[model samples]
Target chain A: MKKESISRIMSGIDDEYIKEAAAPVKKSGNIRRYITVAACIAVVIIAGIILSQADIISPSHFSSEGTTANESGGGDKKFPETATEGTAEAPLDSFITPGEEIDTELAIESVTRPKWEDMIIPMRYGEITLGEITYSSQCTEISSENILSKLGEAKMQGYDIYTDTYYTVTGEAYSVKSISTECAVAVRIDNGEEYFIYVNSWYEPEDLGDFISDLDLKNTVLFRKAFIDEYKHSDTASEHSQRVYADFDDKVIWDMLEDCLSAENTEYNHPYDRIGIETDMPLLGYKNISFCITPDGYIITNILNTQKCFFVGEQKFREFDEYLKNNVPYKEYNTVYELNPDGTIPGKGEDGQSTPGFNPDAPVQISPPYDPSQEEAMSNTQQSSSPEIPQDFIIEETTRTE
Target chain B: MDDSKIITLFFERSQNAVNELSEKYGRLCLQISVNILKNISDSEECVNDAYLALWNNIPPEVPDDLKTYLIKVVRNISLKRYHANTAVKRNSFYDAALSELEEVLTADVSSENEVLFKELSEKINTFLGGLSRENRTFFVCRYYYGDSIKAIAEKTGNTPHLVSVRLMRTREKLKEYLRKEELI
Candidate 1:
């Protein structure tokens, strides 16, 4: 990124967005109550101070009249005296633990998920047989409608489904496992073999997307193949592919592709090839080649090949996925305000442009634009006012444009 | 600028108040946000949000120190954003810092944040007042201004590591004071 672009990103903010995101500071009743309570305390403290100074009330007076006044006076009088001592010299030991130290060098460790519990199942491509398929008596036949219905159910339960491609094949099928929400069915055609198939209706698509997206396909080939195998069962494979392609959209798929291909576009002669696009593909000539609508119209994915890219390794991809998993979409509002170099809002001068380094709201005028003689005089005065003035102040004004 | 005049303008709720605040404290707020958020876009957003928050707040709440007020606003907003973005999957620096604070002030809903913040402000004020001119500047540079220890030491003619040690000790003292007050 250009330095100016980075600076702009750093400084460019939208005011309107902030205004919208900000919770309107309602006149907090609690704050008002606090102020009232503080006022009351202040009044009490001031009164006590005044009375003490006037010698109208003193500790000695309380000691002298104690027993007689204490007995005759109501419980309130006795309470205040006791509370006064209690309030005075309140023990600090209770609040401060000596062991509590702020380590200036303290670096917080990154959070991690439990290995076994959070691990994504690996995908494997291997041959399997029909007789080896353990059919759950309850295991239902696989079909496009069945898969779509299951996916729809998962979506209702907050899952997101993104199908990459679908190819069909007939084989002996096996029922591997069954859970409450869905069952895992393994398909095998030849003898003494098994092919894994994941069937889970309870898998929320949004969560599944996160889970699947995070998976390193090379390492989790078995798991990936399982999904691919099930997807192939549908007759409308082309239609489904189109839908998946459309669903991924340009932005989302590009972001995913960016994660997948850490190589910067600038680094390669053809970065599109790394992102699974055909190198000879006619679409490569565009300044920005974005992906949407697959061959079928089921889903969309974005594809972005940026000039500036950070090479995200496997670990980084995992970290990024973890970040996405934890973070939810938050409302963002932004508004732009012009700023002076010193970082204050800019206001128009007599000339209509903002007066450089001037703040209209400033109570005291800062260093005014200098006439040469006045500048010399101010410097002499500054020297007299503070002998600790730095040497930089004495430099000649060669750079001064005014 | 005259502090009183600035305070007066802020009370008046003039557009100039926003202008002056952004001019005087915009970089400071940006620096605070950047330090916390680490992402330029996010930090920039936080700074803008802080300015708006100050604009809304100053009329009703006349701050004694405008710089501190702006910094606090930026810090709070950036930290909130940080939490929202990273709370579920990954533990964030904000969470760690807050958890550390929770140790000082028990994390009871009633007595935690508001009471601790008020107490912290008081303690910081008292601490700043008690420091020698040089030490006060050093403390401000390291903590309030978030300058590095080496930079602070070089600016003040102290050793780099000495600056670090002094900051560490000061933080411990402040923590102790908070604990002693039973406000932690």
Candidate 2:
């Protein structure tokens, strides 16, 4: 019996058997395969659309080396036309485990992580000592100038300022994850209606610190006001700590509080952890607007009983007493700003005329060691419930062409 | 299940390892055998033999590629079966597969280089690597998988004539590649 030498060469089938195995199987029948083909086309189209809406998927690489790779005839195998000049990183080469064999090309493609580049959310991070007041200030969506300047001073004082694209960033009073690679921050935005991964790696992915700020922001007020503005807005009260509840309009306070939240798509549910009988709850949602303005002027829209004008003994305001009977977390009202508490309905003074607190000339300072209870609650309130960013900024497609 | 997980199951001496391996790669193994032998029952036996081979060899050789490892075993078993069967009756996809390459690749009766076949194989590999992905796939289906030209045509939605012509051109290319490499 003669031996065949070509059989030796045939043993090394360069075909991607692993890839073929990994591909979704379609063995129900021909009809199923046709449906799968249709479904795949739909997925590609949808991926293209949402891909355009955000900076995901590899970019449309224009190369001079475009060759017609369509084969004339043979078995059911397909290969993407891989341009050697393309900038899109191949999943195979981006990661390499330590001490793993580098020689074989056969088993490499299966282990690649889902594209890390897809998760980056371009965010500005800084190490600043502008005091705890900065948290509330930044929460108000005050101009970045105050923070930038303070950050600049902090930088001049030798603190590092980093601007990095994160898979995610969680801001309650401040960014929850200082390191983007540690874990994904699940942020709920669009009023807690959707979830998006804040760039994180449970596997400790490589940190590509791609940019550094050289701006001498020390001359700028970015640091001191990074969170809290150094300058008072025209809406501020001139009097010594004018009562914030009697001062700013409800909409103005709500909008200011709203500005700090990173817009996310997580569906917001009125977070109430009540274990009582279901019949005991009254309307269970959007009952009455309770208000507490933080010492630093951050408006807590729920009944805090801690602000300057803590109590308004109006009868009608007390009529909605059943809703406020249970001390549900105050932030739960964040979803119901439409039913704002009326100042006219809830009297502040016996001869209610106008409000105070807005002094254009005076800068508001919220001294720390104030409201430790609320601060503790803010820390414990799962960043999972908070918004990702103030608004969905149509982030430029980091990889793909829009 | 992951390849390492399956391998770990084997190391732990769990009987489930064989079940998982057979479940995952059974179709692939059967396809390789059926492509060569053309008999369903014979193909089934070949697949079982391939599994046994993998079950025995994996302790000594932990392959990075479980899928490829199984396919190689199935392919070798099927080839040995085909060669043994062909001495009596020259009937199978295996014969039809070798008949085409018999013209361009078979050793010349006049030539006497003992290492010529090994040299030819290395040269053929280099030659296939240089071809377009389509042409290389056709070559693999015919020689490696031992698929009939008509079956390849049906699968690829091409006429049998087109596949025949493509294969003929590829064989010509291989001859030239070997001659240029001085392996002929």
Question: Judged by TM-score, which candidate is best?
Answer: 2
Residue range A1-402, candidate 1, lDDT tens digits: 221121122122223222221212222233433655688778767755664465533232112112211111212222222222112212111222333221111111212222211322111112222221222211222332222212111000100001111112233443322221222333332222333343332121112122222222222221100001011111211101110111112243345544433132112123121222211111111222332212111122221122222233445344433433233221111111323444434454445676554344433213444344675786466436433422211222111121
How would you encode candidate 2's per-residue C-alpha lDDT over A1-402 as one tens digit per residue? Answer: 023545554555554632232232322433433655798778767755664455433334211221221112212222223311212223222132222222222223323322222322211221122221121111112222222111112110110001111212233211222211122122222122332223221111111010000111112111110011111112211111111111112333223323322111111123321111111101111123333322322222221111112121233233222222232112111110111033221113235642342122333222233243474664344133223322211111111011
Which CAPRI category fits model 1? Answer: incorrect
Residue ranges of candidate 1 with Cα displaced over 4 Å = A1-402, B1-16, B58-64, B87-146, B154-157, B174-184
- For each candidate, the alpha-carbon lDDT, in order, equals 0.37, 0.40
- Model 1 chain A scores worst on lDDT over the 10 consecutive residues at A153-162
Name the lDDT value of residue B50 in candidate 1.
83
Q: Residue B41 deviation, candidate 1, in Å?
A: 1.7
TM-score of each: 0.26, 0.33
Model 2 iRMSD vs. native = 11.0
